[model samples]
Target: MEQDVFRLHYEATQARVEEALREQIGRMGRYADLREAMEYSLMAGGKRIRPVLVLESCRMCGGDPETALPFACAVEMIHTYSLIHDDLPAMDDDELRRGRPTNHMVYGEATAILAGDGLLTAAFQALTQADLTAQQRVDAVACLSLAAGPEGMVGGQAMDMAGEGRSLTRSELEQLQSLKTGALIAAAAELGCIAAGGSPEQREAVRRYAQCLGRAFQVQDDILDVTSTDEELGKPTGSDREKEKNTFVSLLGLERSRELVEELTAQAVAALDGFSSRDFLVWLANTLAQRTK
Candidate 1:
């Protein structure tokens, strides 16, 4: 029953984010092909976890979730752009995503790259267009830039690429995942706080929650790669092993990795200790800890 309620909330949030994404894309006028390519991947079905975090965090901070919608859409756009680039032949070389052909596979490589570029730039445009106070907009944009810039997500990707075919210590692997995957997620939570006019303390607490959640998310992904099927994952399973990447499961063994996920989930929920109206966020953390995809 609890799981059903969580799923209902999840689906509702996903629908809201999807609708806003379509509306945001509809605002673009030039480069019809580029728009199509961008939409190809942007509209690809997946859990809109980051945007949901934005909304939920806003609500947790006693703000209207609707006020955060535009920024939420921007976060999703940034995330989708990352996915588009990560699937390029020069990156992970993936041909499928979200159970369909990847952007590059459907639109060709060059266009796909541009599509990613368009999404990334348009994210800031969306931010500018949002109905937000100047301070809120500035804070949100700064949070995103810091997270997505070279020292954050891009840096993490570089580390991941460099670590390929090499042994990495557990800390090294954690750092890599924190930068590559956790950064944007942390940004999502922080942007939510900014959109809500949260104070420094509130933002700091939520950031900690999101950081733990993000790490747990990657740990779950590592576990899924070893345990899930291609059909379930919507991409080839065991690719981590095939690519010779060091993962939590590889380093800690499956049982210990599962334990780590649980511990991280607990830590994430604990970070919400003093906040009220955090039930949804707590459930979200737990659900993500056990996500199958």
Candidate 2:
């Protein structure tokens, strides 16, 4: 019965995210050919996990999904920007994403770079445009900026680049993954609390939950990169091995990585114990840990 409720919620959230993506993208006007490229890449399929996190966290905090929609859209824009930049020639240099040609491959390197920049800027613009109180807007901006800026996602990306082709300690690898993958996820949940005018204690609880879930999500992603097929993953597998990047599976072996994912997922779910209305978040954390791709 619990599983059924979770599945229903997940499906509903997925549909909502899909609808939001289409509506948001439709609002992007054609300034030039670049706009087309941006839309093409933005509409490329993803699991919409981050946006759903935003909505679920907001709802758990007694906020309306409608009130959280802008923040949800903002986080997705940031995530899309990261994917665009990650696939550039100077980065991962992937030719495919979400089972289609990557942004750079389809739109040229320069245009893809510009598209990433556009999405990054647009993310903050969307957050600022949210229909919320002045304080809520301020909190949202601060949380998101920290997540996307040098101290968070960008810093993690730099660390990842630096760590490539080099062995790292378990602590070092975990730290890098936490920043690169977890920061924005944590920010998304925190943004939800902020949007709802949640208390500091409630916000902290959400942040802790997101931090653990982010780690679990990234570890599962690394595991899938090794075990899942491209069709199952909607993207190429074995890219981590190809790139010679440090991942949990590489550092800890597959069995140990799987164990760590379970551990982290449990910790993530545990963090929600203080919240009375965290059914959706608890389900999300467990689902992320158990996801096939």
Those runs of model 1 whose alpha carbons end farther than 4 Å from true positions after fitting are: none
Best by lDDT: 1
The TM-scores of all predictions, comma-separated, are: 0.98, 0.96
lDDT digits (tens) for residues 1-293 of candidate 1: 98799789889989989999999989873675899998888888788899999999998998888899989998899999999999999999988887899999988989999999999999998887777799899888888988998989989999998999998999999999999989999999988888889999999999999999999999999999989999999989999999998899989999999999999999999999989888999999998887888
Error of 2 at 163 (Å): 1.2
Residue 194 of model 1 has an lDDT of: 87
Please give the distance, in angstroms, between residue 73's alpha carbon in candidate 1 and its true position after superposition.
0.8
List where candidate 2 sits over 4 angstroms from the true fold.
none
Task: Give every collision pair in model 2.
Answer: none
Candidate that would win on TM-score = 1
TM-score for candidate 1, please give it: 0.98
Each model's lDDT comes to 0.91, 0.87
